[model samples]
Target: MRILGVYLENIRSFRKGLIVFPPRGITVIQGEVGSGKTSILMSIAYAFETPTGGRVEYADAFATPQPRHLLRTGESRGLIRVLVKQGNRLFLLERVLQREGDRVVNSGNAIYVYELLGEGGLQVKPVLKLRLSSGEYIEKLRSLLGLVEKSGRQRPEVFTNIIYSPQFNLTSILELEPSKRREVIEIALGLSRYTDFRANVSKVIDAIGEKVKGVQLELSRLEDTLRSLDKQGLQSRVKKIEEEKARVKRELEKVVSAREKAEKELEDVNNDILKVNSVIQEKRGLISRLQQENRLLRDKINAVKSKLASYTQVLGVSLDNLDEATKKVEEEIRAIQQRELGLRERLNALITREKDVIAEENRLDAEIAMLERRLGEVESDYREKEGIVKKGICPVCGQRIPHEHGLRLLAELREKAAKIKEELEEARRRRGVVREERSRLRSEIDKVQAELVDLSGTKDRVREAEKLLLELKSLMERVAEVASNEEAIKRMQQEVESLEATLREKKEKYASLKNELNRLREAERAMSNRLSELEGELRTLNDQLQKIQVLEEKLKSLRSELNKLVNSREVVKKVADMVDEVSRVLAQETFKFVSESFTTIFTMLAPDKALSIELSKDYEIRFYYATEKGRGLVVLPSGGQQSVASLALRLAVNQALRAISPRLKDSTLLLDEPTIGLSRELVARLRDLLNKLDEEQRAHIVVVTHDTDLLEAGSTRVRLVLREGATQVSYEGELDKNYRAFVESLIEKPP
Candidate 1:
């Protein structure tokens, strides 16, 4: 897969940028430090690989960039759109990142992959659309790029380790320990399958050995158990127990029959006792009820007699003279009630008359007040006219007036005042008369109230007489009820006596039944104990018979399992030997090719320095240099040499990947700051190496660097500069003029 172009928004230091790469050539991306040159390469990788997306269990934490730092500072959202070409197909991969709480997260639904369709690749069709999780979108992209294995598992290292080498990580593989380096090389070259297979076979061998041990132990245990058991003896003992159990069972049957008879007798006795108890309880309840009734009747008779005596004393008569006394008391009550009625009527009339008087008096007072106001007005008018008369002018017209006219006005005002005074006097006299009448009515009301009070006293005496009369009537009725109560009392007493006698007879019968029940319960207990003892013996014998049968079956199963385990162990050992041989052969062949390629690349980059590297059967990398004093091992090298050696090993591994997988032959080689810590001569050699790869079309080489030496190596050269706070891009060769205006126009526009 080759990246054709990349578009970024708010990614790292870029607010808005677009980088278009040549289809197949060495493209050198040159820029100052922090000019966002590496961001363009990162954007391409980010489209198919998110820092936090996908299955992270197999991912390298240090190698992956943090999502929190991917977005531009002070930005809430970022975008990475990459257009890639594989074979004749064009795919556009996009990934979006957004701020969530305190961290940056990928927008799952915003990630998409679309196939560029139709002519000119203008029309688009979705390959992986919205609503899909970010992991799903990334996996789909990996499949499209042929970065997924046949087992439906993702091989992200193929893209990250072989296809792309991130900034400052060009020599990362060389810095790892020997074992880790071997592991990385194997995975990159697709040789880990053989190692993995050997590992699995070893595990299988160990498991088979454990199974064999377990089976052997179980077989030994079964043999020991078989030796300990004596079948003849067990059979003989079981037979003896059976005979004894049979004898006991015969006796138990006879006892059970006897126990059943006893239980039946006990149940019959219990039933009889229950019946007797029921009859006794009924008799006791009846007697209690009759006794309570008698007590209530006696209390009522006493109350009635006491009330009759009180009435005789209050009325000054005996019970025989009750009629006359009641009649006299009723007449007195009637007389008192008549007087009360007359007084109430008179009092009500007097109250009504007082109300009328008060209303009339109020009216008189209002009229008198009105007259007094009129009189005062007239006097004020007369005084005002007198002053006008002295001036000898007409007050209304403002003209001179005669003195006689003024004097006449004064006399008229005085006369009006006198008349008002007389009328006010008359009103006052009338109001006084009304007040006097009100006072007389009130006096009459008070006198009637006094009379009503006197009547109330008489009413109290009448009420007393009426109470005596009511008592006299009650005494007569009570005397008759007294005779009836005495008769009922005698009857209830006789009933109580009869119930007591019946209760005593039932209690005696209940006692006799209880004694019989206890005797039968004792006999049943004895029989039940004998039956339980026999059942226990039979249970013990049956258990022994079952145990012997189970042991025989288990012995057979153990023998079969032991034989199978022995055969499996042999087969597993053979398979392990075969896998080991294969792994050794494959490892030799793979390492041979990788070591040869490493030697060739390292020599080409450092031809003057007689340095060479060797790959051992264990995947150990050893560097050797020849001098006048024969050959010496390169124990420690300078930064430049280390970079050269690391680059050589990485390129050799890339070659191995291409040689093994046809799909990876045309994959892009992304190098970020590969010239970092390298000498001037080494940078030139690297430039030549990259150009040779491009010439042979081994891969599409894309390099991000700050070295100007690499500019000549690129067929498509691009320059990045930090402008204001964003990155700006410009091409350096044939397309410079054409893209300059377009790039400037883009930068001039708002982001």
Candidate 2:
């Protein structure tokens, strides 16, 4: 695809602009550095691949920070309507980037994009739009040098343009790690499978080593634990049993002391009975004295009554009356005496009763005291007896309590006495109680003793327990001496040992496996390395083969081309012999080509001292008069000469490309600052070249420059100047009667 013309507005350095491209040949775009020469090239790259290749706004390609600022700061939108030619069809690639713009893709207002094509004097919308669907446009555009297709290890245009090379990175390329170096080399050589193989091999080797180390560590820990288990044996049981036996012996002493206390209480109750008997005797004597006194008083009162009766009888006459009165007196006196007698008798009876009661009470007290004393003595005796029994002392005081056991006899005696005393005390308490109540209490006491017997019958259980403990201790000791019988400790030790052994076995197995796996991995790594080497060699051979194939094809084509020159070889040889003359003639032709019409342009743009242009076999340029005389092309000190040389070389390359093949044809010429080092006369000669092109060729030429010295009458002139706060395009075409007249006015005026 070829760009015939572009109507650009408010693009990067072009503000409010419309510039057309000529169809072919050298079309110089004389411009300063900030002018819109590169803008035209970028516009072509954007319009073709807008979504992926370039920014949406052409101003985004510059330092303008925002989209709104791209359009003279206040203008709302920008448009670059591109007129492109594909094959026989001419189509428009319009790109409109607005802040609030409606979406028009490629060159249309519809959802589907279309390109405007000119055919038969009519502008028709063609299906060859700038979209993924337009594969043909991409292919044709790539055929021209405008579109670049990068492949393989070639850096993409994006990275090359965006990334600058630093010295550190350049040095680091040689200082890469072994693996990293291999990786970069693999990438450069395109060895994809070998890279994956080497990575897998490294992982396998690391995994095997990890497994081996883990197993070995586990085995070592297990062996250490198992070794300590053998020392923890079964001698602890004996010490534990001896401690228990001593505890039981201490408990038996408590039982002995308890029995002694019970006996002492019984003795105290018996002593109280003895004291009561003595009190009963003293009360009996008092009862006898009171009874005797009562009898004497009654006899005396009876005698006195009889005496009174006799006196009354002896005194007759009035004595009868007196006697009667006396008798009455006697009777009354007798009655009073009788009453006193009766009172005395009652007092005696009361005293006797009191004595009897006292005696009885004393008896009871004595009995209770005796019983208590007896209980105490019995308890003391019982304690003594129990002590004798436990110490194996004699209980009967004469015969030793033999194999039957002295403690057993004493214990039996104490138990029987205790039961009898308890019954006796119970019976004494119920001395005046109902027979049934006494019987019931006795029965209850019996029941309690029976329960005690039942509780004590299992006393030997503790002894049996002690015996069993001894047996256990002996068995444990034996087990320590001989290993099999000790199940608990032995089993634990065995388990620890088994674990140790198994861990050792596992570690050994892991070691073996790891060794095998290592060997396999090493083999695999070696194989991978070999494969990589082989593949690298194969790729090198293939690249060499491809180069050789390309060379052979080139050689064949060259020979075929040279075959055409076979008849002209003599002429070519003659020309080759006169190389110096040919060189001189070529230099003259180059000078003539540049100094003829374009010399005036170069002279005007350059300073007065240096103004000439040098050309070579490929139209290579050297700034001679532009800087210093006979200065090499590279010796141009100013950036302006470099810009001029760049512009000239770009034009020369396009021309050569077109001349080589019609398929390699390019119609657009973007000359950036073509008249940077030229005089007004040289600029005028260059202006003639610009005006000399035919209308078809003129349609494709777009000159972007700050220099106005090369403006001509036939060209469409646009002047870029800062207005308000931004750049705006003004038509110099209408500034004067002609473009040359308008541009010359400034130079014509005094500096």
Candidate 3:
């Protein structure tokens, strides 16, 4: 359960480095100011466990106006790889940082997680791509580290605090409340069954208490609501309404009969009107088509008149005029050929551009799909956090926060998902705009195609005109201008005659509509009179039915409220029974076991012979000296003895913990400056303490000391030197000479 080596990249004071440990002995990390000795432990903790306070060292590298940072300056990403030998197996736990361009955005670190086997093992695989899995990866790491919670106190916090203690934690822990102190004690001693079981039972009691209060409040409100309605009076009224309902239905049937007779008479009249209207509609359609044909004839007449005027300009010109006309027609044919060629080229170009637009549209659709999936995952994570909070636990710390604070954390999770949804919406809108642009592009391409067709027809007409002009030059006749003009006038008069006939038919359709309108008016007036009478009576009946329905709903709600009261009473009783059972178990078995263990540990840790700890069945702790009993060392005047006693208690706790979990073989004990406040004379005692620690070979002690006097004679010391803005580690005690020996042992025993 000790870290063999820690590899850090882009961490504070060290761009890339490793701090290696001896297989199973004390390895002290000593360094000057700014040498990153603390960073090594931090990196190890960060790699394998969740370290919460602020960001990691040099984290201001991912600075925004917002209070979020993930990396250090000059670092785009960071890595902390912790390699450990748990029992007989070597494993590595890696944590990675991700950055977006320059800034880190999201709630918490986007843990790039992986599980890797060492030089002698299998595959290296990442458990998390962008976010953590439930507990699978954590369980894998804990198993390798032997972090099984046989007692709940042996959880991450217990071992982590022992292995990575800073100066402030010691004093802060001493001043904590009794319950919190008890939590630390149980965890440190590996006797967490009572504490953990009690906490869980307390949570259940609290949760059920809250439910009972809410349920009782709702019952009170339901009773008040029930009182507001007259249930007995409403029941009597219901019978009267039912009788009246039948009488009204009978009277309504008679009115319905009168309405039906009137409807039949009206139907006969309506049929007659429909026949007339049908003929009118048909005549109108024919008139509309004839009007359009007349317009075409008028346009043709005007065009002929214009052509006749042009011919008048060529009076008496014969062969010379024919030659000019032939040349002009040829010129027109060449221009048409050039215009059509340009138009066809434009049509082809537009078609190609339209295809590009369609491709863009498809790309937008794919991008939108990806964004939606991303949003779904974010929303799913948010939902999971909400559930965790409802179960009375903090999502971030894995501890239970206050009820109100947990809800606030739930809101934060939801907001993160909302931000993802906002991004998804933005992508979808862009995709929508692209789709509309694609549609418009398709329409433009269609127009270009239609224009190409029209131009081809124009080109053919120009070529025919050129041939006609050539024929005219070969045979010319001396035509009279007056006669040509007279022929044009005759064609116009025939067009006028056709228009007049179509106008006459439209007038007949208008006359038929007028007659049908008169007949409809007469029949509609008589039927509407009877319809109104029946509708008035029906409205009255409906109003009464609605009133009766409102009362019936009120009665139903009161009955539902009565049922809820019964259910709530049963729930309160059941919850009370559970609370009593758990209390009884704690009072009987767990309390006696912890009381015995606490007294034994207290005796070993205290400096004075008179000091001892006492515990009640309720788990209340009282400390005593030779003459008096106090709550803790707070009443003691001597700081030196207090430090010694605290250390003893801490060691005894760890030893008891070690006895429980064999996997914690040679478990680590980290001290920032545990010898602080000790007298000059006590320096020898401290040295004796270190020597005694090695003699027991019970745990590995790593002390970071500013005082050079603290180092032991034979223990390994890792001197951390800061030079050229980087921290380097130097130690000359051991390498893996036993690597081959250990591997052979594996073949022999195969564990």
Candidate 4:
């Protein structure tokens, strides 16, 4: 914990700075490139992690500028101050950054942390507070610059001493990138148990690739439901609806046999009108007895011609004309008294007009004998309506007779008894023409010769009305051939009962549609055997998911090639035990001053070129070449003698780190120009090994040079004199007055 003292203002090239380090050995702050001399070792590594000299931004070894552009950038504001000493406990910290309204306020809020304690020896003074306000005095100046130490009990989890090895970068260790150089050498070798075994095998292969993508998405939805149940036919459509219900029940039956032969020809015209109504009641009783004997034979022929004309006129006269007449009628009784006095006044006017013409011929012979007793009561009602139409109905109301309405009422009663027997044969032929004129006036009376009596009952009533009209037209043609064979057996019994009721309803709807297509073909054969046993268990889980993805890519390439062969065999056994502990601490601290500073920088840069140099165990430096008689050793490619044997072994590892913490580490030695490519006699033998250190092994020997022969081995010299932008150092204590005024400003070659 050292940073003895440092105070800076506007920090970058450090404007108003002051420095002091004298706690032990080296304290060099040589200036050259941009003349600030690594700004006094970067202001003591930014006051050893910002005592309060705040802007080390959080220390990757300090770079937090911009306190208003660290002041000289057109001047804004910046300041940094630091002073510390832990053992004797003196501390003074101050840091302030600004750029207010636009903000970049490092906000150490005008910090102040003082602690100068000494008490008995009486050097006590400060006890001030605001130590970087809450950053706890920059974490107590990073635990008093052991940088951040305190974890003792073997707590080495890799914090390589806040390493700030700047200069040209090693490309962060030879430009990493071999898996980031095995993650920065496993965080510089802490190796956190192989990074938790590669993060638990990448979380168990991401949960087994999400359970193999959910078993291949449920086997692609059961193979699309077994290919839509084999492209849908759905079982033959129930046998074409049972063959169209057996052809519409054979056809309805011949229309029921023409409606039963028009009801048997209307029953044979009702038995030929009941025998023509009994021959019209026997011709109406013979025309009512010839109209009453033709009015009694015309009243006996006018009584013999009226008594022969009244005896020839009462015996008087015209006897002379009658003498010939008397001779024949005295003679004919005078012609029957001229027809018996005209038939005695026509038999007294025919018995006084036959008593009203025999009372109008017995009132038309009692109206033709009451129309022949109403034609024998219409022939006993036409023989009881022909025995009620041969018993086929209507006896007085048992109604059937439509044999064409009983043959139209027996031809209208035989035309009303043949017109009353032809008006009784024209009244008996006018009574035989008045009895042949009274038998020729009875002069010859009784000449009778009547023998015409051959009436076989009028030819048996006209041969029984022509044999009952030929048996009613042969019983109406046998009832129209038995109603046309009972209408062809009721049309084949309604086509065999409608094809047995459509074959019993198509065998009960095709046996209930083939038992519902055998329960949908056993649910499509149990969903096609459950989609072929889930596609053979998804093809045995896709061959066990491709053998667990090729055994998780060969277990991630054998755990990244076994963490790169166990970090290259632990960085090659920690570079072979750090090159045997750095060659036994460089052979106990110098190794003959690193083999005489690489044979005096390769004999001042390749004298005759059979060069030689070598060191290993990781601090690495080698060069070899051989030809003249020695075999070929060949590796001498002098990049300026390997930059002057790596700047003289980094100034002998900064004087062996001030011979190991000469009091907590700040022995500084920074060389920037480093002799670009050494030549001037190898830069005067690298300033003759930096003047072979003496003043307590060169306690404050700072030497930065534009090579006026290494500032002529300056005891104390300083000279950074830029002009217009204002920077001036120019001091001298010895070096023969700053090496003869820096060799007269380099031979005045101010070209």
Candidate 5:
């Protein structure tokens, strides 16, 4: 697989940029410090997997940062698009930071995979979706790129291994820790795939164990329940309950039968009693009405007798003579009433004249009092004004005054007061005359009142006489009526007494029937209670048996599950062991292939040293200095040898990982400045090694370097210049005449 180009939008120092790799030979991407050469590689890394370890890819310069700081300065969103070609197919992978709000948010964390189509048109459309949605897409991508599914594909794992190595990291794999060295070796021989395969096998084994444990627990519980079931005892109890339930049912039937019979008798008795009660109620009502009529007739007889006796005593005669006496009394009452009416009229006339005279007297008296009060007010005012004048100020006018003016004013007030006093005296004289008139009218009013009282007394006498006459007449009529109905009333009293006796007999018969009905109902209720109790007991026993039957069925199902899981556990264990053995074999084979490559490359890079690669059973890296020398680390004594050996190991690894997947197999290596930090003597040796590599063409290596001597005529150089904080990368096709001359001067070729 080869990276054709990379497009970065809102990524560190390259706001929007594209860098394409040359199609053939070694493509060198060269730049000064901080020219964003490293950032371009990082952008590619972000497109594949984010961050690429120990770096916030889009956070510092133009990237959309994470969480709160997603977008960098002036960047609201960011995108990284990497184009890679494998065989005849090209894929474009784009990772976008979809900013949703003012602040940086994770709305843009989606990745879209596109396939480039239509010849060299560069038109691409989405083929897949990835990023936070699921990890399956990432696994698919790794497979397409010919990478180990679970390998942490760092820069060193792919590009930096043989193609692009930033400064300071150009060392042999042998100098790395044992684990890291092992990782490189294993990747080289495609053993990482087997390692992942082994891990999956182990996971299967764990899952089987967990299922086995759950099944075992259920089996144990089932066994415990089976042991505790007491089947024989349960059977015995069921039989007993069955027998008892049958007996209860039989007894319930008998009781229910008895209850039904008693209820029928109670119903018959209740009907009989209801009829008796209805007839009794009608007779009782008739008796109550007759008794009420007899009581009223007796009361009338006593009232008539009382009035007859009163009239007899008042006139000393029986009520039969009361009509003649009443007529005589009525005539007397009319004559007396006429005389009393005339006296009342005369008294009323005198009273009306007296009221008029008294009203006039009261009016004259009020006017006199008002006149006197006014005169007194004027006198008080005159006195107050006299004092004010003495103080040299008129009180009424609120003015200062001299003594002569004060005296004049006081004299005028005195004269006005005297005139008011004269008027007050005249009002008093008139009031006294009116008071005399009122006294005369009062005496006349008392005489009239006396006459009225006399007439009223006469009227009361007439009223009493009239009332006496009416009573006498009423008593005479009632007495006559009583005389005529005495026999009939006596007959009604006797009939009432007979009805009461009949009502009493009927009520007694109703009571007797009601008692019998109550007795029958009580017996029926007792039987019903007995039946309910028996039925309840039977239902309870049946419920218990049903629950036990359900539990028995569940136990059988649990045992079946236990049998299946136990079989699965055994089979899974065997598979786990087999996978382990396979992983070991693969690891050994991979170590051998990589060991041979490491030794051959190290010898080529440092011919004088002649080192050999060694591998321990645990895959630890070591170098045998010579066939005669003892076992040691794969590290070399010289920095140049160490750098060459590490490069060889990394190349071997990248080659293996790339070749493992059919689609991504390629012979491309991106190596950064390996000539850095080396002495001129060492650099010359590195140059010699590069010349041999160019001749061999075993791999296509893209070097990013300031080592001008490494550039050659056939090399396609991607020159990067620092422009406005961004690295402006130009491919060979776009390199200008003067720029090419400038680059050529800096590149030192092996003569």
Candidate 6:
């Protein structure tokens, strides 16, 4: 890609300016120090270096203290718009930076790319407009410029390090450490894949080695388990255990037969016990029936005698006088009930009187409270009015008043306050009298309640006496009916005795059978316990045998897996070795090509010095010269030679890279202040070399320098002047007609 023109606004030392480049020749930008000569180049580089967003750290192409420092003093925002040409298509790339708080930051949509189509490439069409995020916009820009790196990542280093060399950092590639220099060169030449392939193969080998170790470890563990099984004589032990299990099983069978016999015997005993229990139960039932009849007879007799005794004790009367005693108790109970009713009536009247007193007390309290509230208001008013009187003003109205009138108002307020106080005192006295009446009524109510409670106790006692008299009357009626039951009771007792004797004999027989059944059950439980022990022993032996078999199988499988891992590891190791050899050979061939190019370019630039340079496989530069003794190694004689050598190395790498990558054939080469320390002779040689490079049309070359001698070689020489704190550009060489027109149009009206 080649830069057509660059337009900048509020960018370091340039308020507003545009520089249009020649189409296909060396354009030398010459100006005084700090005259914005370098600013134009920096702006173009900055446009491509703006982080389209990621963790990529590009070289400092702008050479500013910070991004915001690129903006002019007192300016809050800066813009760099570059017009790039790739083949027949033209693109406009824009980057915007603004000052944010204490830091310089890109605008939200900081990058914009557009394609110019239609006639004269003046029609603007949107290509990419995106915020600084995941690098999509920059990737598109790189694709347009053919600047995508070999690793498939869009890197700004191609422009900053390869195509455009920053001011005062022309030898940046040479100044890098050997490894870093090699890495940059390889990436530019699209040879980074060799390095990546080596690294990936190594990682794979490491992974395989780790897998091999794991498999070996597992195999070792399996082998150890097998050895342990052998040490324990597992096969023989299993056989012995099987034999023991068989013997235990036989014992269990014998025990099972014994248990069955015992269970049969127990069953027979249980049958006998059941038969005896039936007989015992029947006899016991008969005895219970006889005993129940006799108990009813005794309870009836006892109840009649108890009633006779209670009647005599409570009423001092026998069954003949029971009616008289009952009548007397009934009369006493009625008297006590009448007294209780009178007491209750008196208590209810007292309670009613107490409630009325409480109501009167509450009313008095309300009245007293109202009077007190009125008194408070009057007092407050009196105090306020007295103050008003002292001030000779009316309290109700904000108006002036005579002293005598104010005093009269205060007197009225005092009189009202005194009346409220007197009413309050009278209501309080009434409330006190009502409270006293309430207390007296409460005391009368309590006394009446006590009398009622005492009456209730006397009534309960009279009710009990009446109940006893009724019971005595009932006993007197039943006494004659209770005929002599002595004979019947004696006969029932004898029958119950006989049945109990028979039941006792049967229970004795059942007890003997139950003891025999218990013995048999105990014997059967022992046999069942032995059988369970045998079963447990058999299960244990079988588990041991299964474990040994599983171990043996695992050992066999592990040995097979170990052999497979070993074979696979050998294959991968061979592949890794082959990859290493291939990588070394590729690097050697690439280095040989770059070295030849470097030697040719360096010889051309410093033909008189007989300097022959060699680039090691590490990309280290070695300068050698012919000598009478032999070819010898030496440091560069001067800074001018070093500059030439560095430039030559850069150009050689660029050439080698372009030869490999056809897309970079049209790439631009930007050299900023390359003649800073070069002698006049060296500068002339550099000019000739650049002119030769330009004539060959190898790449578009743009040189920025203050050396007038170098300007002679440019087909288009541009001069930059600083005036009024702004940069102005003027073309100073014979130019092509179309290019002249293009530059003129850009000056008059920039697109």
Choose the strongest candidate by TM-score: 5
Q: Rank the candidates by TM-score, best first.
A: 5, 1, 6, 3, 2, 4
Please give, for residues 1-751, the per-residue lDDT of candidate 5 as tens digits.
Answer: 6766677666666777666664445667777776766666556545454322344333231221233332335677776666666665555665566555564433434434555557653444456655553244455666766554253433434333334444555663444566765665565555666677767867876887787788678767767766775666655665775676576567656666765765676566566556655655655565566556556666765665564464446544454566676676567668877776776677677668767867876787787788778778888988888778889997767888778888998898788878877877887787778677768767776876787687778667656655755754554455444444555555655665665676566566656656765665675566566556655665665666566677778767767776776787788778768877888876666666656765666565556554555556544445556545664454435665556656666655555545554554564566667666566665566566655665664445567667666655225777778787665767663334553342232211101
Model 6 segments beyond 4 Å from truth? 50-65, 86-91, 108-127, 134-161, 208-582, 625-632, 732-751
lDDT of 1 at 482: 50
Per-residue CA lDDT of model 6 for 619-679, tens digit only, reads: 7878787888888887654677677777888888887876777766666778888887778
User: What C-alpha lDDT values do all the predictions have?
Assistant: 0.71, 0.45, 0.57, 0.46, 0.60, 0.71
lDDT of 2: 0.45
Q: How many backbone clashes does candidate 3 have?
A: 0
Candidate 1 residues lying further than 4 Å off, grouped into runs, are: 45-63, 83-93, 109-163, 211-569, 609-625, 730-751
Task: Show model 5 residue runs off by greater than 4 Å.
Answer: 9-15, 22-26, 32-35, 46-81, 84-108, 115-122, 127-164, 184-230, 243-566, 599-635, 663-669, 675-702, 708-716, 723-726, 733-751
Model 5: how far residue 37 lies from native, Å: 2.4
Query: Tens digit of lDDT per residue, candidate 2, span 1-751?
Result: 4555445566666665554433333333444444555555556544444333333343333211223333333445566556555555554554555644533233321111233344432233435334333334434444433333322222222211111111112122223454553343223222323335445545654554555455455545545554554222322433443455455445545544554554454455445544544444444444444454445445544544444344334423122233344344344444445444554555455455545555555566667677777778878788877766666557676455564676467667677677758866774665444434435545555555555455444433333333333333343334333233233333444444444454444444444444444454454455455545545554554554465556556555545554444435444445444654544554454335433423443443343564557544333445553333554444543654544343343333334333333533545444434455555665665566555543433324555556757556234555555454334444443222332332232112211
Query: Which one wins by TM-score: 2 or 5?
Result: 5
Each candidate structure's TM-score, on Cα atoms with residue i matched to residue i, is 0.48, 0.29, 0.41, 0.21, 0.50, 0.48
**Which lDDT tens digits does candidate 1 get at residues 1-751?**
6776777889998998888776678788999989998678766666666554464432243245545657899999987777666765555666778898887888743334556565544344556544456767766666666664332233344455556767556666666677767777776666777778778877877887788788678778867876786767767766776676676667657666765766676577667656655655665565566666557656665664565565447546555566776676677678888889888988988898899899999999899999999988888888887788799976567688788877777787889999999999999999999999998998889888988888898788667656755754654455555556556656655666665676567567656766765666675566566556655654665666567667678868867876776787788778778877877887787788888988888888988667767767655667788899998898987787777777787788787777776776776778878888877888888889888877775478888888998788888888999999999988876444433343333223311
lDDT-wise, the better of 2 and 6 is 6
Residue-by-residue lDDT tens digits, candidate 4, 1-751: 4444455566666566454444433323345466665454444444333222334333233222224434445445665665555555555556566566655455663233334444432234444445454356556554544432323212111121112223432122322334543343233322323344445445544544554455445445545544554222322322332233233222212222332343343333333333333333333333333433344334433443344444445444232242343344343344444444443443343233334433433445455566566666766777777666776675556877666666567667667777776675665555555555544534322211111112333334334333333333343344434445445544554555545554455455545545554555555555455545545554554555565556556556555554555455555455555555654554444445444554554454446556676654343555676776774544554556666665654455445444544443443344544556678877776665556543436543344445556666555555564455444555554434332342232212111
Q: Cα deviation in Å at residue 68, candidate 6?
A: 2.8
User: What tens digits encode model 3's per-residue C-alpha lDDT throughout 9-95?
Assistant: 667777877666665556667777678776675565455544323343342111111212324456667766665655545555665
| Candidate 6: Cα lDDT at 580 | 79
